[model samples]
Target chain A: MTGRDGGAPLEPLGNTPVVILVRPQMAENIGTTARAMANGGLFHLRLVSPRDGWPQDRAWRTASGADRILEAATVHESVDDAIADLHHVYATCPRPRHIVKTVMTARGGAAELRAATERGLKVGLMFGPERAGLDNEDMARADALIRYPLNPTFMSLNLAQAVMIMAYEWWMAADATPPRTLMTNETHVATKGELENFVSHLVRELDGCGFLRNEQKRPGMVRNLRHFFTRGEVTEQELRTLHGVVRELAHPRRAED
Target chain B: MTGRDGGAPLEPLGNTPVVILVRPQMAENIGTTARAMANGGLFHLRLVSPRDGWPQDRAWRTASGADRILEAATVHESVDDAIADLHHVYATCPRPRHIVKTVMTARGGAAELRAATERGLKVGLMFGPERAGLDNEDMARADALIRYPLNPTFMSLNLAQAVMIMAYEWWMAADATPPRTLMTNETHVATKGELENFVSHLVRELDGCGFLRNEQKRPGMVRNLRHFFTRGEVTEQELRTLHGVVRELAHPRRAED
Candidate 1:
């Protein structure tokens, strides 16, 4: 659909991550996975010896309007050949393979994939068929194991769902920032100098009042004082208010007249 | 499927979230949604006045082996009746409705749902039809909007894929930890007491060196110093090294040496 404003760009953002499905059984799932990939802006697909064979009518029908992805999908006889040109490969393993491997959550894995893409390196995410997940040999060839913290009692995830999560995370991580930006009314956040000055003033006054008695702990105390004001985005107005509050508190009382 | 441990319990984990299809039209999408739900361990499906009548043969066939979910499905004449008992309701919206609402990603939404499940509250996720998403009127009834950051160019996901993403996220968030645990053997992580003692010692040394000049700023500084050490899990060996470093730095130089 076109953007409501009618000026939205027609192109999707970022490089597409290659999705490799190994020994996938159902045509419907491959279609759905393609649909899901297209939904999240990923288009490159590689099928490794699909059980039902390729070019199935059912996948085309189920893919809805995502015919481009299905048409572009490449079929490979082996996992090695499918990811031969890819610099980074992630294997989604539902169960632990009893071997030592670096494990990452979907979010973490996507971040790494985004980084790889930024360096112009090809990246691929591999998924096993519905029944058995990636074999040890398949996983041994991958860079890392992408594991979800699924409920122990029921851990099975649909093949498409697994692909969708990784794709969504990759899209989000590759973006400039989150879509929704807080409306700040044209006011820029307070500068580091502004925050530092206010914090230093506050600390100096507190020190004069014999607040910081532990002389040996001055640096850390100052840093802590600095952090309190800098932990969040300090607005211009808020910074002024803090400066005023500090001056008022540290002011000497001339007997109330 | 049996667990790798051989005697793993057969019961599904967590409460079954209600999947309410609000005005869903396609029989295939509904069937696929059932299959996706079953894949992620959700069984309580409530159809809110589907365009096609309930007990759809297509949905059953598409559901693959998830016949139990279809057999247990419930149909309601209206959205109100469908989610009347649900304490929390999430409406999946593909586009911005231009109305004020809390928006969350699938991951955040799932975490909230898992928390609600722990509280024993009835939780329901509602999906609109394929073409036009939840209208403003339909969205008014929802507590929050579940938004996925899809590519602007191709932002549509298959209804079942949408359902599957939400379900998968819920399952992941409801679990203990990601499936694979990094092997951090032998050396235990530093205890809270160890961290606190180290921070105190460091702070005392810094204070003596005239670093923490501000008295009132001491508490915040101490907290920040402690935070720096405890931000990540520090091993026992690392903590011991930190202690030795602090002691050595604070030591007074001997004239003979």
Candidate 2:
């Protein structure tokens, strides 16, 4: 028993962006970040190369009731692997970068993420390490930048602060009851990992059939193909179908050896 | 030098709401709340009857660089004294009260507060103790209520989270995202894979127990079972618990394995 709904269990809010922290330092910040995310109604968390490593006891201690997010959190060795399953990704930085991408305020970025989730796209919001924030290399990979509009003179934002602002916006932008929620939840949309697997499978098939005969342009061709599919939302069943199609195309049924 | 504003003196942002913590328990949280407020560009802080009294070193130490806000913070003996000079007041509560008052989202409330201040009125946003939030008497005194659009099922908000949200909203003032609708559930819905895994586990256990021995009806029984659980929302933790249940039932341990 806890409060008015004393016996009720705590569950995370669904269909929000995947909050990815890139190279985060300090276990306490990660823990506090989880609490902030939970408060703002965000659930999914991905950590790319946490400095002290995952399963830290300090993080659990600080997370309070939000240890559930930490328990379900997935750890990635690289940013690419972290966002492989996502269709859209935005990076949160404190300052402007030289990249030619759309820069959005916290609310604007959150609205965009919410709209994408409603469209069935799995989106991610990435934050850089506490020290220097996101580098240009990481900035180049993101579709856009989410910059919090803090006071110009006193622009002091920690990891938890940045996450909570977006989280608040994400929660507010939602219609509370989404129209496509049931279908989206039921289909159990293919994760970026699943989609990536299918893409790699298709690329391998294309390579075997000489579809990209020009070696110099193969990487660009492959990139185009991946983007074409990555931009679309696919369900688990759809990925299975795509995998089957690629398998059949690569190995004809005429010789089932 | 911090970011691009190194070696520059920081000036407080103008026209933001006053933050009041009523009967706050921890001094460390008071410090962190000041930091959260500063991050969101709000500086005015008022404490009402702090549990351990004022001038807490723990609070100043935990405040990071935000001790300036704490230094300017004023302490009052009661809630009325805290908001005596405020022209408008909004209590941040997690739940709806029996008292009839306009319930505004955090953003909406912030916008309203900004408009009031712009009209040359003092405004205060009050938060209750960490244990049980604002009481009915305290809530009844406010001009309106500001409830965050958090997940209804897991609406566990702390003092710092509430302060940061109001501070962020008041600081932005330009956000146009419509506010005030809260999501229904707290439990995170299980992904398709997690659901499928649970179904497969249950079906396998049923087979082991000879529950699906009938040749013609086995598929129908499995279908019915899957549909029964699939029709409802089961969180990831719930699914894990279900998996454990099936495992235990299939091979019950006599107290221990």
Top candidate on DockQ is 1
Candidate 2: residue A115 Cα off by (Å): 1.8
Residue lDDT tens for model 2, B10-124: 4466666788998999999899798778766778899999999998999988676776889999999989998988889988877663343467777778778878988989888
Docking class of 2: incorrect
- Candidate 1 at A128: error in angstroms? 3.1
Candidate 2, residue A59: CA error in Å?
A: 2.2
Task: Look at candidate 2 and give me any clashing residue pairs.
Answer: A11-B186, A85-A192, A85-A193
Q: Give the share of true interchain contacts found in each model.
A: 0.22, 0.19
Q: Lowest summed-lDDT stretch of 10 residues in model 1 chain A?
A: A1-10
lDDT accuracy of residue A164 in candidate 1: 78
**DockQ, in order, for the candidates?**
0.11, 0.08
For model 1, report DockQ.
0.11
Docking level of model 1: incorrect
Q: Which ranges in model 2 have alpha carbons more than 4 Å from their true place?
A: A1-14, A176-257, B1-12, B174-257
